[model samples]
Target: MDLKLSERYEDYREAVRVFLEEHRSVWRQPMADSDGRPSAAGRSWQALLIEHGYTCRTIPKQYGGHGGKADILESFIAAEEFHRVGAPTGLANQGISMFVPTLLECGTPEQKERWIRPTISGEIVWCQGYSEPGAGSDLANLQTRAVEDGEDFVVNGQKIWTSSAHFSDMMFVLVRTEPEAPKHHGISYLILSMDTPGIEVRPLKTMTGRAEFNEVFFTDVRLPKTQIVGERGAGWQVANTTLKHERGMLGDPGQANAMLGRVVAIMEEETLDGVRLIEHSGLQDRLLRLQARAQAMKLHGLRLLTHGLKGEDAGVARLIVKLNGTILNHEIAAFAIDVLGELGALYEDSPHLKDRGFWQTTHMFSLGLIIGGGTSQIQKNIISERGLGMPREPKPASKGA
Candidate 1:
C-alpha cells in the first residue's frame, strides 16, 4: 500500500512549509491582532495567513473560504504547520469550521449571506448554546425555553460550560420550544444577536486561571422568526449536526505529535541522576510508546482522509481517533508531570518553573480533553452501539426519588 501523500499533495506540502517558514520568527511571538488574540501581532499574523490562504483550506470559496471543497489532508497540513510553530491556531474559527459548514448544510440562502463572510473575517463571533446547568450530557433534558410569540421567540434559560460566550457577538442556541412534547422532539435551534436585551454572560474560570468558558443566562431575550436555523421542531436533528461537527473538530493528530515532540526536546535537554534523560531506559521506553501511538493516530487520520475522498464511511475512524487523541494526550501530560517533578507544583509567575509552568497547565488541560466535545464515556457508547453494533443493555425508567 502507498503510505505517502500523492505528488500533488506533496507539492502542496512543500509550498506550505516554505510559506510558513517565512513567518516562523513572527509566529514565535505574534501580537494579538483580533479580539481573540490578546496582542495585535498575533491577530495580524493570522490575518496574513488568511490573506495568503494558509488557513481555512477546508472551507469552500463561496463563503470567503478556499479551494472550493473540504480538502482534509490540506486542512490537516495547514493546521500542522501552524501548531508546529507553537502559534495560536485560533483564527476566525467558529465560522471557518463549525458554523459555516452547518450553515451550508442547513441554513437559508439569506442566513448564509448574512453570517458566513463576517464570521470568517472575524467581524462577528458565535457561541454554542446547547448545554444548560440542568442538561449537559443528557442534552435532550434541557429546560431553556424559547416561546414562539408572533414573529419572535422569547428565550429564557441559562447555558453553562459555554466556551467563548463572553466574547461572542452572536449565539447559535438550542432551546425547548415545545414544553409538553417529548424531550428531544421539542427542541429548536436559533441564531440571535448577543446584544439582545435580557441576555447575560458571566465568565467561568478554570484551574489554569483562564476564563475560557461562560455561563450565559437569558431573561426573555427575543429573536426574530427568521433567525431559526431549520424547522422549529427539527432542531433536535439540526443540533445533532452542529454537535457532530464539534466532536469531529476534536481530531488533531498533528497537535498531539507536536506535544510529543516538545516532550522529546525536554528529554534531550534535561538530565536525570547526572545522566541525560535521553539515556534513561524507562523514560525512553515510555517516550517510544507515545511516539508509536502518535504515529498510529497520524496514519489513522490519513486512512480516514482516503476513505472520505472515496465517499466511504469513515465514522469508525472518527470515533476511534477522538478517543485515541484524548487518551494519548492525557498520557503525554502525565509523563510530563513526572519529568517536571517538584517543578510541576509551581504555577503562574515562578521563575524556577520548567517551560513557564506549561507542564502543570497542560496536565490540567488534559483532564478536560477527556470531557470536552464529548466525554470518554460517551465515545465508548458510540463505539459499542454504533461502530460495533453491540446490543444496548435494557434499561427501566428511573423511579421518582
Candidate 2:
C-alpha cells in the first residue's frame, strides 16, 4: 500500500531513515534471545534506538516515553524502512510491541513509573511467563502457583518455552493466586526479578541448533503483592491485553513486506535449469500473489491504525492478522528455500553461501512465528468464535454427569 505521507509524518520518516543510515555499521541480523527480541548485541542496538527518538514514541510524557500525538502507523512505517535498510530498530521487540501497550492501558501510576522507563530504555529486559509445560496453547490452564503471604506472593511453578529468560533481568509472570478459584479466575500477573533466589533459567535447545529459549523454574520466588499489574486473580484478563498486542504485532503486514523483499531479492538473482527464477511465469505469479497479500495486509494494518488515531477500535481485521501474516511468512520463506535448492538449506557448514544459510534459519524460525503469540489453530478458533460470532464447540461432560 502506498502511504499518503503528509507533512505530519514526512519529518518523522526522514528522521528514521537518517537513523538507519548513520547506524548501519552496528547492523547485523538482530539476534533474538527467545521471545524474538534482540539478545546480546540486540540490547546495544535497542539502547541506541531509544537514545534517538525512533522508539518509545507512544509512551506518555510523564512515564518517560517520547510522548506526543504520534499515530500507530508511524511505527509501522518505521518498521518497513528499518527492514529495507537491514537496520535493527528494536521497535518491534515483544517488550515494546506487546508489553508497553498493555501497560499504557492498565498500568497504575506507580507501576508505569517504576517499569516503563527502564523497559523502554532497554536497561531491563523481560521474558513472558505465560506458557507452561502444560499451558502452551491452552494458556489459562496454567498450573504455576503463587500463594499469598502478607505483602508478598510466593511463587512456585515452571514455565517452558520462555525466550531469552536466561539473558533477562525481569519477567512478567502469570501464576495461579487462588488455587480454589476457578482455573481462569485465580491467576495473577506479576513482575518478578530474575535475580530472586530460587529462580532458575536453563537453556533449552531448539531444532535450529541455537538456544534462545529456556525452562524457568521458580521455587518460593517472592514478589511483593504490589508487583501485580491488575487486581489479584485478574491475571487472565491482563494476559489477554498482552496477547492482543502480541497477535497484532505477529500479524503485522510490515513484517510480511520484509519477508517478501527477501524472497524477491532471491528470485531475481536465482536460476533453475539455467533460467532466471523470476523469469519463470509460474514463479513470477507466485511472487505477485505474495506481493499482493503483503500489500493487502499492509493496507489493512493502515486501516486499523487510522481507526486507532480516530480513537476507534482497530476493527474486525485484528482477529485474522496473526494467522494470515504468519502463514504467508512461512510460505514466502519456503518459496525461497525451494528456489535456492541446496544452498538455502546450508547452515554454518556453508558459511560461503548466501545469507550464511540464514534462509534455513529463517525457515525454522517461521514455525515459531506460527506457534508463538497463539498457535494458528487457536487463531482460527478466535476468528470463528470471536470474529464471525460462531458458536463454540461443546465441551465433554464430566463423568459425574
Candidate 3:
C-alpha cells in the first residue's frame, strides 16, 4: 500500500487544521454534561461543524447535514485533526452515529424529514431498544409486544441495557407485531417518544460509576401505526441496518489509535525504579507490539475503505473489526494501568489520580465494548460460518427430539 497521501489530501488536511484553529475557542469548550450527554454548548458546536462540512457530511443538506459527497479520506483527515486538537468532530450518540444512517437507508421521506433534522442537529436524542431481559445476543428472541388497535399500537414490555434511555427524547425500538410468525419475521421497528405515558426509565450504574445504560419499561404505551419504519412483520431487516452501523461505530480504528496514543503518553510520563516506564525494556517490548497492532488496524481500515470506494464487498474483513478493535482497545487501557501500577487504581475522586483516572474509566468501559456491539464470541461465529464457509454449531434437539 502507498504510505504517502496525495497532494489533494495534503491540502485537505491543512484546510481542516485551519478550520479547527479558526474555531478553537468554541470547539475547545466543554461539549458534554457530566454524564457525557451532549450539552447546549456541545450542540451548538456540532451545528457549527455541520455548517462547515466537518461532520455528518455525507447526509443530504435538506436533512440538516453538511451534504458533502462521501469521501473516506476526508473523513479520516477530519477525525485525525479533531483528535489531535481534542475537539469533538461530532457528538457521539445512537441518534447520529447509529440511527441516522439506518433512517436514511430505510425510512420514508416524511419520516426522514421529520426526525433527521432534529436528530442530526442535536435538538433530539434517541436510544436503541433492541435488547431485552431475555434477548440480547439472540435479539430475535425479544418478547416486547405491540398489538395493533384502531390505527395505533399498544406496546408493553421491558428493554434492558438501553444506553441513554433516561436522557433521550425518543427511541427506535423493536416489538413483536405478529406472534404467530417466525421468531425473526414477526417483529417490527417503531419510534416512540420517551415521555409517552406509562413509560419508565431506571438507570443502571456501570463499573465506571456512570448510569449511561438503563432499563426502560413500557406499560401499555400507545404509539401511532405510522411510527413503524418498515413493514409490520419485517423489523428484523430494518434492525440489521442499525446493527451494521452500530458495529462500525464500535470498531472505529481512530478510537483504537486514540487509546493507544494515551497509553504511550502514560508510559512516557510514568516511572519506576528512578526511571521512566518507557525506559524499561519489558515495557518497551509491549509498547512496540501495541504500536504494531495499531498500525495494522489502520492499514486494514484503509483496505476496507478502498473496497467501499470501489463498491466491492469486504466480506469477513469488515466483520472482524468490531471484535479485534475492542479487544485491542481493552488491552491498551490495561497496559496503561500496568504502567501506572498502584496509582492506576485511583479514580476521579482521588486527589492523587493520574490523568484524572481517565484510563481507569476507559479500562472498565473498554471491557463493555467487547460485549456491546456484538459479543466477541458471536462475532467469531459470524466470521467462521458466514465468512469462512465453516459449518455452524448444531442446535441441541428440543427436549426429546
Candidate 4:
C-alpha cells in the first residue's frame, strides 16, 4: 500500500478538518437523554449531515452520493473529523455504511433505484433484523420464517437487539424459507416496511440508560416478493454480503482514532491522588499501546480498501480489524473508568460529572459492540478457521440427542 496521500486527498483531508472545527460547538451537545436514547437533537444532527452532503460520502453519485472513492483512508479522514467534534455520525453509520453497500452489491436495479436514492437523501431510515431471540452469535440458528404467499412473503418470528428499530422506517431481515434444510441453507433476505401490520417494535433500555436497540416481533407480516435481494434459499450467501458491509463500517479507522483522542482528552482532564490521570505511567503505557494498535488497524483498513479498489479479495482482514476495534473500545472505556474512579459510576446528568458521564456511557456502549454484528468469540473462530486455516473446534453434543 502506498500510504502516501496525493495533493487532492491532502486538500480533502484539510477540508474535512476545517469543517469539523467549524461545527465543533454544534456537535458537542449532549446526545442522549437520561434514558440513554438519542435525543431529538441527535436525529436533527443526522439530517444536518444529509443537508451538508457528508452522509453520502461513499455512496455513488448515481445514487445521490458524492461518489468519491470509497477508500478507507478517505473514510478514516471523515470519521476522524466527525468524532473529533463529537458529531452524530453513528446515527447514520448503519444506513450509509452497511445498508447502502449491501444495496449496491446485491439489490436489484429497481431496488437500488427505489431505496438507495431515498436512503441517501435521508428520506428513509433502515434498521437491521438479523439477531433473533435465539440466534445472535449463532446467526444461522435463526428461526424467523418467511413463507411464500403469492407475490409476497408472510414473515413471522421475533428479532431482538435490532438497533434503531424503534425509529427506523424500514428493515433488512434474514428469514428461514426452508426449515428442514441445513441450518445455513434455506434462508432468505428480505426488506420490510416497518409500518406493515403485525410488525411490533419493543424498545429495550440498556445499561447505558438508552433504548438504542429494540426487540422486533413480526406476525404474518406481508412483504413483497420483490423485497428478496438474492436467490431464495441462498440467503446465507447473500447474508455474507451484508455482514461484510457491516464489518467494514465497524472497523473503520477514523472512528477508532477519533474515539482514542476523546478518551485521551478525558484522561488528561481527570486527576487522581493529586496527579493527572494521563501522568500515570501505567495508564500512559496502556494508552500508548492502544494508540499504536489503533494506527495499525487504521492502516490495515486502508490496505483492505486499496485491495478492494484493485479488485482483490481482502479475505479475513476485516475480522482482524473488528477484533482489534472491539478490544480498543473496551480498553479505552476501562481506562476512562480508571481515571474517573468513583465518579465514573455515576450515569449521565449526575452532579460533578465529567463530559456528561461519558465514561459510564462508554463502558455500557462498548459491550454492545462486542455482541453486535458478531461476538468476540465468533470473530476469533472466523480468524482461526478462515484466516489461519485452523481446524474447526469440535461441536458440542446435543442435549437430548
TM-scores, all models, native as reference: 0.89, 0.85, 0.93, 0.81
C-alpha lDDT values of all predictions: 0.77, 0.77, 0.86, 0.76
Clashing pairs in 4: 35-209, 36-209, 36-210
lDDT of 1 by residue, 264-293 (tens): 888888887898887889988988988898
Q: What does candidate 4's lDDT look like per residue over 1-401, in tens digits?
A: 36777998788789887876776666677654554445566555555565555666556767766665556556666766666555667455356666778778888888888888767555577888888879877889999999988988999999998887877888988999998899988899788889999999998998777787889999899988888888888888876876665533533566666677887887788777778888999988988988887788777767777776566777787558767787778777877787677887777667888777776777778888876767888889999999889999888988995
Worst 10-residue lDDT window for candidate 3 reads 244-253
Please write out the lDDT profile of model 3 over residues 22-99, one tens digit for every residue.
Answer: 888887778888756688889989988998887788789999999887676777778778877877777877888877
Candidate 3 matches the true fold with a TM-score of 0.93
In terms of TM-score, which candidate is stronger, 1 or 3?
3
Residue 266, model 4: Cα distance from true site in angstroms: 4.6
Q: Which stretches of candidate 4 lie over 4 Å from their true place?
A: 1-4, 15-60, 67-72, 82-93, 243-273, 278-318, 394-401
Clashing pairs in 2: none
The residue-by-residue lDDT of candidate 2 on 1-401, one tens digit each, is: 45588887888788888878877766674556555545666666766765554666556767767665555657766777876776666644346666767777788988788888778766677878888989988888999998889988899989998887877788888899888998889898888889999899999998788996899999999888888888889988987876555433423457777777877888888878888888989878888888898889887877776666566765457778778888888888887787787777677776657877777887888888898878999989988998888999897887894
Question: How do the candidates rank by TM-score, highest first?
Answer: 3, 1, 2, 4
Which candidate achieves the best lDDT against the true structure?
3
